[model samples]
Each structure stands twice: as structure tokens, then as C-alpha cells.
Target: MPLKELAERRAILHRKSDPQTIVKHALDDVQLGKVAMVSSFGAESVVLLHMISQTAPDTPILFIDTEMLFPETLQYQKDVAEELGLTNVQVVKPSREKLLEQDVDGILHTIDPDACCALRKTQPLEDALEGYDAWITGRKRYQSGSRAELPVYEKSGRKIKINPLADWNAAKLVAYIEEHNLPKHPLVARGFQSLGCAPCTTKTKPGEDPRAGRWRGQDKSECGIHIVDGKVVRQRNAA
Candidate 1:
């Protein structure tokens, strides 16, 4: 099916259902090789990775290594992928030439993070997702200001984006992780409630928003991977 029609269909089915039910139904439509799960391998990522590993260990898992991530995050990604015994994990990366061409100055993120994200993340994944009909994500509505109203399913160009935890809160995510004994990003233990690129993330204070550490002190929230109504907008700022 075309992406728009599939999205419309998904929306119709998810009108009143919860996130788990939506994921269950989406899995039923899987044909083994047509779907993929895209994970940020961030703080709250383990829950969805665990779910997918349990649901379909053989499913291709796409992990985008933005090349700017923390060493701990890269290690965590490797650790989780191995521990879960995920058979088809593929690490996608931005081209070296592209990185050199676009960000040789290394301050593109400082001047325009949206462009940096587009260069390192969005473009790479968009290219990698060429043949996949749908991809799963771990976005929860309560994570940040921008994601406060996320939907279970969304249309992104020619692909279907599924947010299986759209209705979940932080407490629920923590419970799920603890119950599964899931591995979290190492930075999480050091007060980094959220994890992104090394330069863009920081440690949050008590009672600060979970995503307050991302792009700290900057007016950037989301890394442009997910957009709203076809326009990219920052969901939160690291205050």
C-alpha cells in the first residue's frame, strides 16, 4: 500500500485503542522482512528494544550511529544488542564524506542543530528506510514539551512511523525497564536523564524534565527525526 493510505488505515484503527494494542496489531501485519525497528538507544529505548526482541528477534533493528554519540551510548547499544540476542541489528551511519563536508567546522550544531540532525540522522535513516513499509519507535507523550501529544501512528513521507509507547508515562517506562532488567544508557546513572549526541546532552537536576539535558541551554529538543504536520519543531530545550 502507499504510505498515505497505510497511514490513514492505521489512524482509523488506532482512533480509540491503546499503544500496546496498536503494536500488537502492527506485528500481525508483518511479513518477517518488511518492517524494521529504529531505536535511538537512548535512556528510554530499552523498553521498546526489549519488546521487539521478544516479539521478533529476527526483525532487522536499525541503530543510527550519528558518529557524534557518547562513547557510553555506543557501548550501551552494543551491550543491549548482544544481551538481547537480536540477530539482525544493523548500525546505520552518516557517510564520512558527508560529515566532513557538512560539519567539518563541528559547530553546525551550535549554529543550526536542525541541519546537523538532518545531516547526521534524518538523511541517513531516510536513505536506509527506502524499502521498509514501517518502522517502530519508543516515543512517549510525557517525555518532553513537544511530544506531549504524540499519536500512536503517524505518516512520514512514504513510511509509517509507529510510536508504541505514545500514551505511556515516565513511571511506566521505569517499571517496564526494571521488570525486564533492561540495560540503560550509562549516562543515565550520571544524572543524564536523556541521551543524545555527546556535545548536545547534559545532566539534568532534580525535578527537571527528563529531556532537559538534550541540547542543553539551547532552543532545540527533538533532533529532527520526528516532525509534526510536516514541519520540524523542537520539543524541548535544555534549560
Candidate 2:
């Protein structure tokens, strides 16, 4: 389909429906070359994972294993995907050669998180999504100030980014998880509302922003994926 037609459809869908309706349409779009669900499999990700499992289990689910992630998160990802019966779970990772060149000591999160993230999270996915026309995310507006104005569909370069749960809140996420008996990210109960690389993430305290646990003290809130492209683009916005 032409970009104009898709833009018009996105506008109408954004106004007339709920998250599920919007998500369904994006999955059903035939003109997009390929679509994938980039999930962190963090606290609120189960809602979207479960939705896609039911609506389109065969769709590619890209999970970035930054190699710095929590072990609990790794296990949780495996369990959730299997339990949901989601097929095509692709694990994307940064290359060892690049790590040796750019982040040799592996303490890049201490020196420069954005650069580390670009190498570990963004580039690999960018390579992975060479021809994909769009991807879906679980980001919600209530998570942070930057994402407060997130739209269901965003045109990024030549690709369409889908935030199926853009209107969902903390309570809605909890309700979905409980209602579906979805497994929580292993760190949530310990107060990690957001999960990212182990070196950068911390546990959130009461009254802090939902994503305060991520890149804790750094002024950086995003890992640059949201600003540019790939789960490759799914960077800093999601869990």
C-alpha cells in the first residue's frame, strides 16, 4: 500500500479503536513486507506477548539478549514464550568483535550508555530488520514523560512503529497479567519496574517514575532505539 493510504488508516485507527483493535489491524496489514514483535519480556510485556500469541503466534518475536541482562530475565523470557505458545522467538545480540573493539572492558555502561546501547541493542536489530516494514511494542504513555504523548502508530523513516498499549496504564497492565495468569518479570516484585542491561538497571523506589530503575543515575532515559530504528528500534522505550 502507498504510504499516504497507510498514514490515513493509522489516523482513523488511532481515533476509533482500542489497543487490541489497533494491534489487530497492524498485524493484518498485507502490504508491509514483514512484521515483528520486539519484546523485552519485562514486567508489562506479557500483555502484548499474550495478545500476539493468540492473534498471530507465527509472527517473529525479537528479544534482544544484550548479554548484560539479568539471569532471571533470561529465564522469564523462555518461560513466557513457551507458555504462551509463541513461535518464532528470535534472540538478537551484539557481535563479540564489536564488543572487543568498542566496549573492550565491558564497562561501557559506566562510561557511556548510549554508545554501549547502540552497539549492543540497536545495531544488531538494525541488521536483523533489514527489510521489515514495521514492528510492534508494548510501550505505554503512563510510563514516563517522554512517552506520555506516544501514538498508536508512528512513522519512523520508512517504517511504521506500532505501540499497541500506548493508552494502557499501570493498573491496566496488572489487570491483564492477573487475568491471564501471565508470569511477571522476575524482578518486578523486587521493585524493578523496568528491566534492561544488568549494569544499568536498578530497583525502583516508591514514588519514583515507572522507569526510574533503568540507567539509574544517568541523565539518559532512552537507549536510542525509540529515537531511531530496530527491538533494533524498540530500544529505550520498552521495558
Candidate 3:
């Protein structure tokens, strides 16, 4: 099936459904039998992860560990998986040899963030997802920038990208987390609204976009993972 048609058909089928229902439909895809969920396991990650744990506990969950990530994030990833009984958590990382060659000093993020992300995140994820035909993500439209127009379903290459939470907002996220008593990323209470690699993420101030804390001073918003169809779409920085 074509990616566009697949996304459209699924979107129509789940038009009136909730985010969890959208997730369930993606998990049940016959053509894309081996779907994976890519999660950051950051501040707002628990919602989708918790949904996946109930909908498909065995589904592979990809967690890209940029060597630059916060220690809290690493521990949060482990704790979340254990707490949810997620059995197929796959840890993806840039190869040691490549890191030694391209970013030996670990300062690539300072000179070229795009290269840094491609080296640590994009390429590693692309390599890890070689055999999968579809993947689920935790993006929401309210996150801003190009994501402000995010769709519930979209096709990327031969795979269908499902954004089950595309319509959710901060209020919904907060309510869901509190209602479920989900654990938060340790940095949230410390004023870090968005959690990414420690070196890139910073503290968000009052009335700022939730993601303002990510890549604080840079012109970048995303870490190069949220490509739109075939084009590399850069998100807006600073709400």
C-alpha cells in the first residue's frame, strides 16, 4: 500500500477515536506488521509509553541515547520501562567507532548541531529501524513550529508515521500524568520543560514554550528526527 493512502485510510478509520485507539490501530497494521514506538522518555513521554504498555507491551520501543544525554534521562528510561513492564525496550546509540572519528572531543554540538544530531540521533535511528515499515511517535501540534500543523497520520518514505497525540495540549498532558500518577523526568521539577541531551537542553522560564528549554540558544528546535514526508523540516525555536 502507498504511504499516503495508508495514512489517509487509517486516519479516516480512527477519526473519532482517542489517542490510545489510534495507537491500537497502528499496532494492528497488517502490511506494516513490525511497527516500533520511538520514545524520548522525557518530560511528557510517559503518556504514550503507558499507552503502549497496555496496547502492546511486546512492541519494540526505540530509545536513542545520545552519549550527551543527562544521567537522569538514562535512569528515567530504565525506570519507566521497568515500571511499565515494557519488555522490548531497544537502546539505540551512535557507534563507538563513528563517535571516536567524528566527535572525539564531543563538541560537535557547539560547531554544527545538525551534524551532531545526524551522527548521534538520525543515523542511529535510521539504522536501527531498517526493517520496520511504520513507527509511532509522541509529537503534538501544540509543541509549535512545523509541529503546530502536525497530523494524526503521515507517510515518511515507505513507513507510516503515527502521531497519536498530535491533538493533545499541555493541559491534557498534565491531567493524564496526574490521573495516572505517572513518574516525570527528574529535570521537570527543576524547570526543564523539555528534556533532550543534557548539553543542549536548558531551563525554560515563566510563560515560555514548553520546548523553549531545548537547544536554548541555537536556531534549532528539533534534533533532526521529525522529517516531514521526504523533506527535512526544521521546527520553530522559542514559542
Candidate 4:
């Protein structure tokens, strides 16, 4: 279950079939009641969530509630879950002791965003994902820097990571949302192209990169939840 072996296993799976095939295979092969989906409830998350809800409504949907997130995000999460009729939308949160120990100053995001993300997102997710054999994600290829090369299926230790939207683009996402009359995050229309924690996100201007607002002014971009190889590489830092 080492990182290297996991990557090797993921590579082998990727070579065997395309992304769509991988998703179908995972859905069919993974044991019932043992799978879950991790959703950010961001700009384009509804597409995959809808797909999963239709394909497997009973599957548990895990949403991380980092206390630093915008209030609008929390509302949107509820709306989306209700609209989609998601049966099991469990909200995972970081433990108070862990947050107090790591973010006692409440300014860790400004001084050390990586560590803050590790505490709020990575560690909490690692804990939430325990006992699951496979999980679904909403990653797409045309999203940003590193995500442009995302694979459909990956191996994370002993668990299977499935990206059902790996081949989707921004235009397709928007189109699907509109066609379905899905509710969007309020910040999306206000120029916040990419939404994350309140302080880490900003509104972008025309011609500016969609993710430019994330960790603005700083070299930091991703929150380290999605890693590559054995190291934690941010989405913006890659490629």
C-alpha cells in the first residue's frame, strides 16, 4: 500500500481502459454499501453528483465542512443535496482538538496555507475515507494546471479513486447545470470563478485565471487534498 505501489497500480488500471469504462467498472465491481462520493459542492460539482445520484442514490455522499468555508458554500451544499434527493449526505468536520492544536493563532492560512489545508482537509478526509473500498470524485481535465492531466481511475493505497468527470470541460459543466436547472454557488456569478475557503478565495477579473483568486498573491494554490505520486502537490503548482 505504499505510495509508489499505489501509483503503479493506478497506472496499470489507466492503461487497461478509458475513463468512462473505468467508472462503469468501478460502479459495477465495487461492493454495494462500501462506496462513497466526495463532493466539494463547487461550481461544477452538480454534474457528477447528479450522475451518481441517478446511478446510485443510496451511496453515501461525504462533504467536508471546513469551518473556514463561506456561508454561501454551506447553503449551496444543502440545496444541492436536497434538490438531488441525495439520501446520505454526511458532512465531515475536523476535530476541535486538532484545529485548536494546529490553528491556535487563527492565521495559519496566511502564514502556512499548506499546513492549514493539511489540518482542515487532508487529515479530515483521510479519516472520513476509512473503511471504504472505493470513492468517487468530481475532477475534470480542463479545470486547471495539474488537473488537466487527471486520470479516470487511480489507486490511493488500498482504495480506488474514481474521477467520473475526467473528460468534461467547463462549457460542458455549465451547459449541464443550466439544462438541469441546478442551483449554483452564489459566488460563481459574482466573479468568484473558483470557490474555496472564505479567506483563500477571491473574485477574479476578466482575462484573469479562474483559480487566480485562490491563495492570491502567494505562490500557493491547491489545498493538497488531491496528491500525485508520493508527494502532496497543489493543482496550480503542477505543470
Candidate 5:
């Protein structure tokens, strides 16, 4: 389908529909063709994951392990999946050959963060999403500047990216988690409101944006996973 039509469909989907309804529509619609849920298992992630679990327990949940993530995140991924009974949780990782060729020492993030994220995140996720026509995300408008206008469905490359929580805010997320008794990522307690690979992630300061810690002191906001108008909008920080 053309991008314009997809936008129209997104408008219809967003009209009077809640987060769980969007998730259910994506998973149950055969036209979507092999849907998967991509999650970082970060703070506020369990809300969407829990929605997916309740909607469809066996939905494919792709968790990218950049291999540089915090040990806490790694354990949290396992714990959340088991706790939610998410049977098809797939642990995706950067390619061994690609890592050897590009970031053998795993310090590429220190030199060029965008290139590092492309290698460790974008490319690996592209590979993992090869056969899928649609994928779900836990992204919200409150996350970052780039995602401030996030839609319920977006056209990314050849796939339809679904953001069920696009309209959600921090308060709603907390309430949902509290009501569901969902597990939170361990690092959130340490001030890491937005979790990513350990090397680029730091604890956010009080009154700062939740994503302030990611790629701190850098002009980067997103990790290159978010594509807009068929282009990667990785560095959205303007001088």
C-alpha cells in the first residue's frame, strides 16, 4: 500500500481506539502478515508488553540485545517474558561477522555513536524483521523530540511500524503498570528513565528529560531505530 493510504488507515485506527485495541488489530489482521513486537524492555515498556500478552500470549516479541546492554536489562528481559508468559520472545543480537568487521572491540560507540547504533541496532533489527510485514513498538509521544508526533501506524521502509502507545503519557503508563502489577526494569530505580546499551546510557538528572542520559553530551537523540519518511532520523538534537 502507498504511504498515503497507510496514513489514512492509521487515522481510522487511532479514532476512538485504545492501545490494546491497536495491538489486537495488528496481531489479528492477516493483512499485516506475521506481526512482531519490538521492545527494548526499558522503563515504561512493560505497559505495552503486558497489553500484548493479554491480547495474544504467543505474539512474537523481539528484544534486541545489543550485546552492550546493562546486565540488569538482560535479566529484566528474561524476567518480564517469563512473568508475562510471553512464549515467543526472541533475543536478537548484532551479527557476529558484522561485529567483527565493524566493532570488534565494541568501542565504536565512543567514536561514532550513529554508526555504532546502525551496526548494533538498525541493521540487526532490519534482519530480524525481514519476513515480517508489520511490527509493534512501545514508543510514545512523550519519549523524545523526534517521537513527539508519533502516530499509531507509520510506514518504515517496507514494513508498517505500529506504536500502540503513541498517545500515552508518563502518568498513564505508571497507572497501567500499577493496576497490572507489571515488573519495571531495574535500572529505572537508579535514575535511568530511558534505557539503552550500557556504554551510551547514564542516569538522568533531576528535572531533565527522561532521555537526557542517552548519548549524553552528544547531538544524538534516537538510536537510529526510528525511521521517518523512509529515512533514519537518528540525530535530532539541533544546536
Candidate 6:
């Protein structure tokens, strides 16, 4: 039941399994206890979503609508769920009271992106994951940064975080999507490789890292939602 022990055990058991098999195990393993899939429904999201749909259509899928997300992303989330027939896609968002108290005017991201992420994303997700013992993520090594050496299974706080596609590369994901005819995020067509909140996300140029567009020109790469290898990075508002 310990995070490390559980993660190591599951990793060893599924060392040779593919992403889909790992997904099935995550959803069906009773030890995981009410596992849920957290998706951004951004570019490259449909692959894992499609996998979950096939493995367990009723699995709870958490989609954090930072509310500052692009209009295209908003619609894409709805379209992907309906297209996949995912039965339990829960829309998570920062509470109105928290928003009013910390990010009134919705411009906190302009001044302090870290605190903004904490209020909008990390805090809300932590609240949403209250009863779940494990959660699935769509992270892949090919995306680079701290994620470059990501493991298939890792311990996040008290929860077991499973990265089914940790080893998958962009080419492999493209091939899989094309082979399965999975739908892509609408912004992908306009060169947005990694999708996040609309204001913080930008278009990734050719030959740049897929996530180069996120928090562009800033020192931040992750939204604190994934600051999880060992440190729990949450920026609190001065207020």
C-alpha cells in the first residue's frame, strides 16, 4: 500500500507490457482503488483517451478546465469525450471563491504564473483526486525537460502516478494515432505542439521541442501539476 512499494511492484509486473496493457491494469487492478485518468484533452491526448475508452469506458476522466483555456481546447474536450463515448469525464476547475480571492480579474498568470497555476490547476486537481489511490497521466519522455527520464510508474505524494506512455516518442504516437484514426486537438493544425491554458501556451516552431511553447520565455516548463518526482511544488498566493 506504500506508494514506493506499490509502484515498484506494479512496474516489475508490467515491465514488458505495452501502454494499452498498462492502461487496462491501472483501471482494473483493485489495489489501485478507484483509479482515474487525468487528461488535458490537448494535442496527443486522444491516444491514451482512446486506449482508456477501449479498456474501460466508464473510468473517471478528470479534465481540468483552467477556464483560461483556449476556446478550441474547450470544444475539443467535449468532442473527444463524445467521440470516445467516455462515460465519466468530470470537469474540474478552480473554485470561484479561490479565484475571486487570489486571481481576481484573472490576470494572476500575467504577474505570478506559479501561484496562478497553483490556484487554477494544482490545487483544484489535488482536491479532485481526494478518493483516488492512483491516477493515469499522458506524459511521455519525448516531450523533454524533467519528463525526459520519466518512469512508467512513480509515486506522487500519497498516490501512485502511472505514465503508460512514458517511453513513447512523437513518431510512435503519430503512427499510433494515424493507424487508429484518433482525433487531434484542433490547435495542433496551427502548430501548437503542447497545449496548456491559452494565455500561457504558444505555437511551437519547427524543430523546437514539442513543449517549447508552454510558458514561453519563462523559466517554468511544468505547471506545478507535475512537479512530482520528489518535491511537491505549490506556489501560494501572498494574499
The positional error of residue 219 in candidate 3, measured at the CA in angstroms, is 1.8
Q: Estimate the TM-score of every prediction.
A: 0.89, 0.91, 0.96, 0.86, 0.95, 0.95
Model 5: per-residue Cα lDDT over 130-163, one tens digit each: 9798899988888777777778887887788888
Model 4 RMSD vs true structure: 3.3
**Cα lDDT, model 1, residue 164:** 83
> What TM-score does candidate 3 get on C-alpha atoms?
0.96
Instruction: Give the alpha carbon lDDT tens digit for every residue of 69-166 in model 6.
Output: 99999999999899999999999999999899998898999999989999999999999999898899999987866676778888888889999999
State the lDDT at 233 in candidate 1: 69
Error of 1 at 89 (Å): 1.1
- Candidate 3 per-residue C-alpha lDDT over 6-121 given as tens digits, one digit per residue, 9 for 90 to 100: 78888777777899988887898786568999999998999999999989899999999998899999999999999999999999999999999999999999999999999999
Better of 1 and 6 by TM-score: 6
lDDT (0 to 1) per candidate: 0.81, 0.82, 0.88, 0.76, 0.86, 0.89
What would the per-residue lDDT of candidate 1 be over residues 1-239, giving only the tens digit for each residue?
66666767777778788655766677777532267888888888888888877777887789999888998889898899999988888899998898899899778888888889999998898888888977888887777777776777777755678888888888988898888888877778889888888888889899888888787777778888786545676644533
- TM-score, prediction 6: 0.95
- Structure candidate 1, residue pairs in collision: 217-238
lDDT of 1 at 129: 86
The C-alpha stretches of model 1 lying farther than 4 A from their native spots are: 1-5, 12-21, 30-33, 235-239
How does model 3 fare in lDDT?
Answer: 0.88
Better by TM-score, candidate 5 or 3: 3
Question: In model 6, which runs have C-alpha deviations exceeding 4 angstroms?
Answer: 233-239
lDDT value, candidate 4, whole model: 0.76
Q: Residue 34 of model 2: what lDDT?
A: 76
